[model samples]
Target: MIRVKDIITRINSSSISRRMGQGLVWSFTGTALAKFLTLLVGIICAHILQKEAYGEFSMVRSTINMFIVLGSAGLGVTSTKYIAEYREKQADKIPAVYAATNYFGLLMAIITAILILLGAPFIANNILHHPSIVLPVRVGAVLLFFSIINGVQNGALMGFENFKAIAINTLLGSVLESVLTIFGAYYFGVNGAILGFGMGFILIFVTNHLSINKNFSAIHIKKLSIKKLHLKDFSILYTYSLPAALSALLITPSFWLIRSILVRAEGFQELAVFEAADQWKVIILFVPTAFSQIVLPILSSLHKEKTSFVSTLKYNMLIVGVTALLLSVGVMLFGGFIMRLYGATYDNSVPVQILAISTIFSALANVLEMAVYSLGKMWQCFAINIVWALLMVGCSYYLCMRGEGANGLSMAVLISYVVSFLMFLVYTIIVVRKEVK
Candidate 1:
C-alpha cells in the first residue's frame, strides 16, 4: 500500500498528470451520462417497439454512428494531434488546425450526409432488403452531419484540454436525445426514435461548437479568411488528416458488415439479441476509452518531443488489465442475469457470454491500438485494422452462411478479436523496443 501510494504520488506530480487526470474526470462524467442514457434509450425502445422494430432502430442508429466516423475523415484525430503539437512548439500554426477542422469537417459532413441520404434506398432495398427502413435511414442521416461537426468541435477542444465544455456538451446532448427518444418512440414508434436519436447529435454539435469557439476564439475570421489559408496550410492539414480518415474509413464499414451478416443469415431477432449483449461490451470498453481520449493529446505532445512515454502507457494498460480481469469474471458469473433485463425474449445468455469473453481481447486491443496511435503509427495501425476488418467480415460471412446463426457470428468475432489483439500487442512491443533504443 505504501509503494502504491508513492507511485500514485509520483504520477500525480508529473507535468502531464493534471491534464490526464482532469481529462479522465470530465470524460468519465460525460461518458457515464451518455452511455447510461444510451442504455436507457435502448431499454425504452425495446419496451416500446416490437422486436423487429427495435432491431431496425438499433441498425439505423449504428449506421449513423458509422457514417459520421467515415465523414469526419479522422480530422478529429488530426486536429487533436496537430493542435497539441503546434501549441507546444509553433503557436502560429494553431489557427490553421482550427480553420481546417471547421471548413473541412463541415464539407466532409455535408458530403457524408448526402451520401447516406442518397444511398438509403439502395442500402435498405438492395442490400438489406428492408424497404420499410428507407425513410428512417434518411432521417438518421441528419445526425451524420451534426455528429461530424461535433467531432470537429470536440477534437479542437480536446487538443485544448477543455474538458468542462466537452463534459457539459456531451451530457446535455445525450440527456436531450434520450428524453426525446423516449417521447418519440412512445408517440411515433421506430422511425420517430431514429430521428429523435439524431437530435442528440444536433444538440451536442451546436452547443459544443459554440462553447469551443468561445473558449479559444477558435473561429477567428482573420485566420480563417480565404487569403490566410495558404495552400501549404491545406497541404499540412490534409496530410495528417488523410491517414487518420483512411483508418476510420477502413474501420467503420466493418460495423455494417457485422450487422448485415446477422440480419441476413438469421433475422431481426438475432440482431436484437446480439445488439443487447453487445451493449455490455460497450460498458466494459467505456472507461478505457475515456482514458485513451485523455491520453491521446498528451501522447501527441510527448511523441512530438521524442520523449519516452512507456511508463504512462504501462500505467494506462495496467488500469485496463485489472478492469478486464474483474469484468471478465463478472460477465462469466452474471451473464444470464444481464440479458434478463432486456426483457423475457432475451433469455439466451450464450451470445452475451461469448461477447463478455471477447471484451477481454477487445480491451487489450484497444489499449495497444491507442499506443500505436500515440506513436503516430497510423499507417501501420491502418494495415492491422485492414487485416482485422477483412478477417472479421470474411469469417463472419462464411460462418453466418453456414447457417450456424448468431452464435457462430459471435464465435467468429471472438476469434478474430483475439487474433487482432495478439498482433497489436506484438506490433506495439516491437515498435516500443525500437523507440527505446
Candidate 2:
C-alpha cells in the first residue's frame, strides 16, 4: 500500500515533481480565483438581465468563441508544443519559432477579425436569428483579435513555465473583467456585458504581450519579431496547426449549432437555463484545466522518453479522474442551490446535474487529448473531435426538435464526451503499444 508520507517525500525529492507541484499550485489558485470572479459576474448578469436577454448574451458569446477558433488557427497549442519541446533541446531556435508563430498568429487574427466584422450582420440575422445583436457581434470581432493574440502568448508563457506571471495576469484580468461586466449588466444589459467582455480580453492581451517580451529576453532572444520568415519552422507549425484548427472547427461550431438549435426550437428562455448550468460546469472544470495546462508542458518535454511519457500520462489520468469525481458529486448535491444563485428562473437542477456528470468524462478526455498533442499526433486529435462533434450536434438537433430544451442539450453534451473519452482511451492504448514496439 502507498503511504501519504512516502508520496510527499518523493514529490519533494524530485526536481520535476517539485516544479509540477509549484505550477499546479499557482495554476489552480489562479484558475479558482478567476473562475470565481467570472461566476460572480455571471450571477450578476443573470440577476440584472431578463432570461431572454441573458440567453442572447450566451448566444453572442458562443458565436464569438466560434469565430475565435478561426482567429487563433490552433496556434496556441502549436506554440505550447514547439516552445516546450525546443526551449530545452534546441534553445538557439527559440527565437525563430517564436517569431514565426507570432507572425502567422497576427496574420490569422487580422484576417479572421476582418471576416467576423464584415459578416457580423449576416451572422446575427441568419445564424443567430437575432438581428438586434449585430453591434455586440461586431464588437466581439475586436475581442477575437485580442483573444487570438493572447492565446499564442499565453501558450508561450506556459511553455516557459512562468506560472507566476500567468497567475498575476489572471488575477488582474479577472478583477477588471468582473468590474466591467457587472457594471455593464447592471446598467445597460446584454450589449454592455459583451462590450465589457471585449475590454477585458484587450487588457489581458496587453499584459500577455508584456510577459512575452520578458520571457523572450530571459531566453536571450533580442527581439520578438520575424525579421526573416523561417519556412521550415513555419511549415512545422502549420502542419500541426491545421489539424488542430480543423478540430476546433469541428468542436466549437458544433456547440454553437447546438445552442442555435435550442434557441430556435425552444426559445431564449430555455437557452438561458442551459447557459446557467454551463456556468457551473465551467466552475467544476477549472481544476482539471489547471492540471491539463501543466500536463502539456511536462508531457511535451517528455515526449521523446516513452517510459516517462506513459507513466506521466497514467498519473495524470488518475489525478483528473479522482478530482473530477469529487467535483461532480458536489455539483450533483448542490446543483439546484447553485442554479438558484443565477436567479429563480435558473433553478432547474436536472440539466445542471446531467452536465455535472459530463464534467467527469470531459476532464479525463481532455487529459488524453493533451497527451496526443504532446506526442504531436494532431491528426488523431482532429479525428476524435470530428466524431464527438457529429455525435453531439446530431443528438442535440434531434432532441431540440422533440422540445427537450436544456435537458436534451445537456444530455447530448454528456453523451458526446463519454463517447469521445472511450475513443481517446482506445487511441492512447494503441499509441502506447506502438511506443513499446
State which candidate has the highest lDDT.
Answer: 2
List pairs with backbone clashes in candidate 2: none
Per-residue C-alpha lDDT of model 1 across residues 212-314, encoded as one tens digit per residue:
6675565342346655787777774556677778878877779687888889989889999888888887877777677778777777777633333665666
Badly placed stretches (over 4 Å) of model 1 are 1-10, 217-223, 304-308
TM-score of each: 0.93, 0.96
For model 2, where is the 10-residue window of minimal lDDT?
Answer: 2-11
- Per-residue alpha-carbon lDDT of candidate 2 for residues 1-437, written as tens digits (9 for 90 to 100): 54545554544554667668888899877768988998888877877887888888889988888877777778888878888888886877777777777788899899989998999999989887889999988888877888888778887888888887788787778888889887887788888899887777788888888988898788776554565665676886658888998998898889899999999998889999999899889888888888888888888888777756766677677778889999999999998898888877676899999999999999999999998888888999999999999999999999989988899999999999999999999998898667532
**Model 1 — which ten-residue stretch has the worst lDDT?**
1-10
**Predicted model with the maximum TM-score:** 2
For model 2 the TM-score comes to 0.96
Question: How accurate locally, in lDDT, is each candidate?
Answer: 0.80, 0.84
